[model samples]
Target chain A: MFKSSRFPIYYKGHPRMFVKDKPIFWWALKWVHARFIIRELTSVPVAFYAIILILQIRALSLGPEAYANFTNWLKTPLSLSLHVISFLFVIYHSVTWFNLAPKAIVIRIGKNRIPGLVITGLNYVAWAIFSVAIAWLFLNLDNLM
Target chain B: MKKSSEPFWWALFGAGGVISALFIPVILFIQGLAIPLGWIESPNYQHLYQLFGSPVTRLFLLALISLSLLHWAHRFRFTLYDGLQVKHLNVLIAIFCYGGAILGSLAAGYYLWLI
Candidate 1:
């Protein structure tokens, strides 16, 4: 678990002011700021994947030729790099999302709080169902379209 | 602060659920912008896509982004304050975290419009 630092002070009979070492060094300050920015930017890939999913669905609907062209374009080196970064983002997002899941939905039955792992398990089940539904629809598009 | 921390986690949990509920279903259903489920489609998904594509969707997106940003900002603000024992530059850090979300929401809005 991420936690704050606990500094001990051993002064008796008086209240002493407590403070951490100041960030007098510029490099250290810059490093701290950069770390926060990087973590926040990691969320970008989740946004990107969402956009790509939309585009891929649209392209597929257009035609097989268009879908092939779009996917081929997506497979290019630059696109691959973006996908790689986005994949990392997706993993991070999923983990954070899952870790945060139990708190999101709490089912209470007969005076017992639902387990967090149970919540996560249900989420995975839902995602599985959703993925299958989408795949099924797309696979049968020829007949349905 | 410690006493209130318990409820903070609960709030965070509720916020996360709200975010997922709004995002996931749309993602699962959106057949690549082609299968407009609700308003854009026939009676099958009518009123649904309309709900998502309408100004209301934009509003919800804005709210989600804004609220989530604030939620994230608050989490990070304390992370810095407590984890790093940051005290001197508290205001500056607060501004960056919350301001980043404000700016981010604006960007999301622009993209939403472009799309």
Candidate 2:
């Protein structure tokens, strides 16, 4: 598409003009491409969470004793290996989740992209509040039991 | 089936949404029942496993996994074509993407059923 604009060019790949001919737009385009790759790679955590969800279901279906057994085993060295891997996966999932939140929910002032980082940051803030509330509720529940 | 006017990826995305939304809720419901109601003395809460327990839930989960993976596969196919300078292999990539999704979904279903 960039090539279509009819601009007069005398030399085709002449070594003398090479340095001067390179446009700023080329560098900016490459930078944007790299950013897309970064975004895609980081989103692997989203897929990883789906696998984790399946694993949790399997553990539960095995019965209460099996569930306890699984939990106990999870504390062991071998199980800890998987846990460590899953921990990394969970972090990735959370990061991607927050990243996507901005796209899924539009926050606009007349007309705007809403600034992606600002949208992502607000998601983290909301999660923090939710976490505190849940922790408080869980602690109270534990006391009752 | 309709392979001319529309691309296969669109179908996969629609299928995935239908599958995941249907299965995840059912799985949640079955598992949620385990929470004590104070009425039953010894409730089998563990039976309410996520999306893996009941036959019906398993079917939906399998469908979800298949459709979703396929949908993403289609997405990645387009990504490869547009982003990676792989436009020449677009047709091959699209087929592979759909095939992989179907295979993945089937594998998920099989594994869930076996246990």
Candidate 3:
């Protein structure tokens, strides 16, 4: 499609329809490609949640009143629903990305390579560790009120 | 047809993708889910403020927000090109996407500093 157009007058005798390149939205053609596109789209919500975190920081700077207001905003049904959707999309992003870990990193043990499931499972294992550590820290914060 | 500097942005994209996948989800679960749903009590504002006061926290926050922005920039650039079929304004799109990310990162840093 980027090339300069080349054309012939249907070979001068028998007119034939010319095939064009797939439209830009070609991702719709397959489930794999569509899911890939959806993965790409997750960046929007990821950045969005980051913005909210930054806002939380700003509110933190302002003292409890501002933070309380931010919490109040978040407690609204609309904000809660948005967070739920964002959480789901974030999970989708994580699952797809983690699933691709095996492809991105080939683990070789001398002569034999690690099985794909083991490689992929390692990602989940690491995830579980980090998450549990964070959960423990978050849950056991003695100073939390 | 020519060699492009896409790999640089892509490196940032990949780093950001991994960071978000590994770390952001749990934070989302905590702030976006647990706190709101009362599965966990909201930590006192002072406690969180103290958490953010550390230089380490500031730096970690910097990495998280900056990489995520750059990730968005790179992805949004391709999204425009492929999804919307914007063929002619390539350079402008790159400038807008990456530049916007840079600006947003700086803003995040500034706010983080204030925090």
The TM-score each candidate achieves on chain A is: 0.57, 0.50, 0.76
Cα displacement (Å) at residue A90, model 2: 9.1
Better of 1 and 2 by DockQ: 2
- In candidate 1, residue A144 scores what lDDT? 56
Highest TM-score: give the candidate number. 3
Q: On residues B10-90, what C-alpha lDDT tens digit does candidate 2 reach at each position?
A: 665545433332233222222222122222222233334432466776765566566656545655665565456455666
The residue ranges of model 3 lying beyond 4 angstroms of the native Cα positions read A1-21, A107-114, B1-3
What is candidate 3's TM-score against the reference? 0.86
Residue ranges of candidate 2 with Cα displaced over 4 Å = A1-145, B1-8, B14-51
DockQ of 3: 0.60
Compared with the true structure, what per-residue lDDT tens digits does model 3 show for residues B15-78? 8888878878888888878888899987677777888877998898888888888888888789
What is the alpha-carbon RMSD of candidate 2 to the true structure?
A: 10.2
Candidate 1 interface CA RMSD, Å: 9.4
Q: Ranking by lDDT, best first?
A: 3, 1, 2
Q: After superposing candidate 1 on the true structure, give the runs of residues whose Cα lies further than 4 Å from its correct spot.
A: A1-82, A103-105, A130-145, B1-72, B79-86, B110-115
Candidate 2, residue B99: Cα displacement in angstroms equals 1.8
- Assess the local accuracy of residue B45 in candidate 2 as a C-alpha lDDT between 0 and 100: 38
Tens-place lDDT per residue, model 2, A1-145, is 1221234344555534322233423423687765555444332322333444455455665566766665455456664454445445434434555766666667788876588789888767765565455334333443433
lDDT of 1 by residue, B11-39 (tens): 74346334533353444334323243222
